[model samples]
Structure formats: C-alpha cells, structure tokens
Target: MRKKRALAGSGAALALGLAAGYPCLWRHACLTWGATAVEVHREMPGDALLPTAPLVTTRAVTVGAGPAEIWPWLVQMGPGRGGAYTYDWIENLMGLDMHSADRILPEFQDLGLGDTMRLGRNGPVMEVAGLDSGHALVFRSQDGAWVWSFGLYPSRHGTRLVSRNRIQPPDPSPLYRLFSLYVMEPGSLVMERRMLLGIKQRAEEPIAGR
Candidate 1:
C-alpha cells in the first residue's frame, strides 16, 4: 500500500508539471518552452571526489553602486512588476513569454518572504524567502525546481552582486542532472548577468539613496 501510494504521488507530480505544448515538465513553471536537453557534470580536486551536489550554479556581476542601490532592482523583479533585465527582443521573439523582473511591491519596505511573484499567463510564481535587507534574497518554487538567490557585498570599485541557483529534479529522471549542468546553468548565467547589468544601470541613474 505504501509503495502504491508513493508511485501514485510521483505520477501526479510528473503530470502536474507536464503542461500542454511543452514536451518538458517544469518542476516549477517559469515559462513554457520546448524540450530542453542539458548535460550534468560532477567533478572535484584530484583524489577527493565530492559527491555530486544538487546541480547548482553561480553567476556574478559587478555594479557601480552599493548594495542598497542594487537591492530595489531585485526586490522589484516580477512579471508585471519589474521587467526581467533580459533582452526584450530575444524574449519577445521566443513567443508567449512572461515574467518580467520588475514585477514587485510598490514600496521596497514591503518586500519580504512569502511574497508571490508571478509570471505570464499562469507561469510559476516564485515565493520570496531568505531575505536579508541589502544583503541577500532567495526565491524558491515548489517541487524544489528552482532555488535562486542573490548575495551582495562591497567591492573595491563599488558593489559585487552574485546570483546563485540550485535546481533539483522534480523526479528521479536522468535528464535532471544533464539539464542542471548544461541548459539551466547556461540559462542562469545569461539571465543573472543581464539582471545585474539592469540593476547597475538603474542604480547608477538618479534615485534617492537609502
């Protein structure tokens, strides 16, 4: 009975993510896309082989301003809020895209955990968590599909922002590891860089410093 229940649960989980049109199943729906193929890698120094960590990747960007300057951009990111720093041309070309980074609270002070950030046409909503004022913010989705965070620190020039994502396969499918290393990691790299760039541009522009 226990085994049967577990199997049933797994099936339901998979079914839930496999939305129409997209062959791929989303652990947390970001936006519907075609089947994406990714490659996974597990490596460590010489003799010490660190067990494969849950396909995590990190991307970094430098801002000309301070963390306080950069905080608002991240907090404001959402579909209807702040448009994602990503390229508008490319995103629009992709078709039926949603989820802009700018979508967020009107007031920065209101930003906090449990806030639901939505995307286009019922795309997955990332729940805010692990928020540290002007320091860090983490957004997570159900099924452990996405664990994205931003960490800000002082730099000699100005401020450095690092965005990290840790993704876990919703199911024990072989494709999970591959996608983490290849597709998701690369996508994260591209998106995070654009995000930081957008933050930097906005922060450096005119805005009352906090």
Candidate 2:
C-alpha cells in the first residue's frame, strides 16, 4: 500500500511539473516562431509576393561576412543545387533529396528572375519573383499562395540576413488558421532556424586562398 501511494504521488508531481512547464513552452514558441513587432511593421521588399497575406513570419540572423559572400549561398539553394542547408536527414525523409554543399559551385551561381527552384523532389515549386543581386531574392509559389524572401543588409558586424515567409493557405477557414498558428509556426521555426544558422556558418568560413 505504501509503494502504491508513493508511485501515485510521484505521478501527480510529474503531471504538475509538466502542466507548469507548458506555459513557458508556449511563450517561447510564440516569441521565437511568430514575427516580432519590428518585423511585423517593417516593410519587406518581398511583400509584393503575396500582396496581402494574413500570415507572415520573419526571421533574421547576423552573419560575419559581407552580402556578396552570402549572396552565393542564397542563389544556389535548392534540391539540385547547394541544397536547403538545413537537416538533410529530415529533408530527405520528406523526399527533398537534399545534399548541402560545402563549397560554392560555379554552375549554380547564375540564378535570375523567373527561374524555377525546386524545393524538394515532390515539394512545391518556387519561381524567382524578385532579385536584387547581393541585396535580396524573392520567390513565389506557382499558385501564388506562398512567398519566401531573403534579404541582406550591411551591418556594423558584417551583414544581416533576413528571411521572410508569406503564406496564404488555400483554405482560410478558422480551422486552417488555427492549424497554422499551432502546428505550422512551431515546425517552421525549427527548420528555418537551422537553415539560417547553416548559412551563417558557411558565410563566415574563410575562402580558400583568400
């Protein structure tokens, strides 16, 4: 009887701990996954991609390299190119066939407006909608439901890389909106954070012979 009571008490304590921790987890997810006030108000060049998307997410990171160095990585990102620069195993599980490159490839360096970049083997296709060379690149889905943009700005340290995604789900029902807020936001945060950090690491690496 004593052992049973102790086990019950421990289980109750564990449940209480989990219940107490849930709020912190939600708060962290909201702040990290959702756009900040500045990002929400700041006008992004890629805003034209969706024009009026109700859902927007902005994530930024400072890189220790100039915009020129970062531009190459952005331009060459895709399934058949330099890869998404995120977790290859996760992306491969989703059939992206990602193989991130460690060095710049010349053939993939010549991206231009209107070119189609494959996200995964069977994932959505994104067409280049806007290009500002070393400044920004914006891509829009063929259906016009999704727009993703990458911006580079000169900073005191080196460069600030900002990634913004605008998504207008085909179904704007409350259920879909709720799903996006609760599910998509957290998932996107995980993938995007990794991609941004990956870019930062690659951009900061010293160029061979330079």
Q: What digit string (tens of lDDT, one per residue) describes model 1 on residues 120-170?
A: 454556788678888888877644466677777787978867665665566
- Clash counts for all predictions: 17, 0
Best by lDDT: 2
Model 2 alpha-carbon drift over 4 Å, by segment:
1-40, 207-210
Worst 10 residues of 1 by lDDT: 39-48
For model 2, how does the per-residue alpha-carbon lDDT over 33-143 read when each residue is reduced to its tens digit?
Answer: 434466556777879768788777788888889999999999999887899889999888988878999888899999988999666766688999999999999999888
lDDT score, candidate 2: 0.82
Q: In order, what lDDT does every prediction score?
A: 0.59, 0.82
Off-target runs (Cα >4 Å) in candidate 1 are 1-53, 89-109, 175-182, 207-210
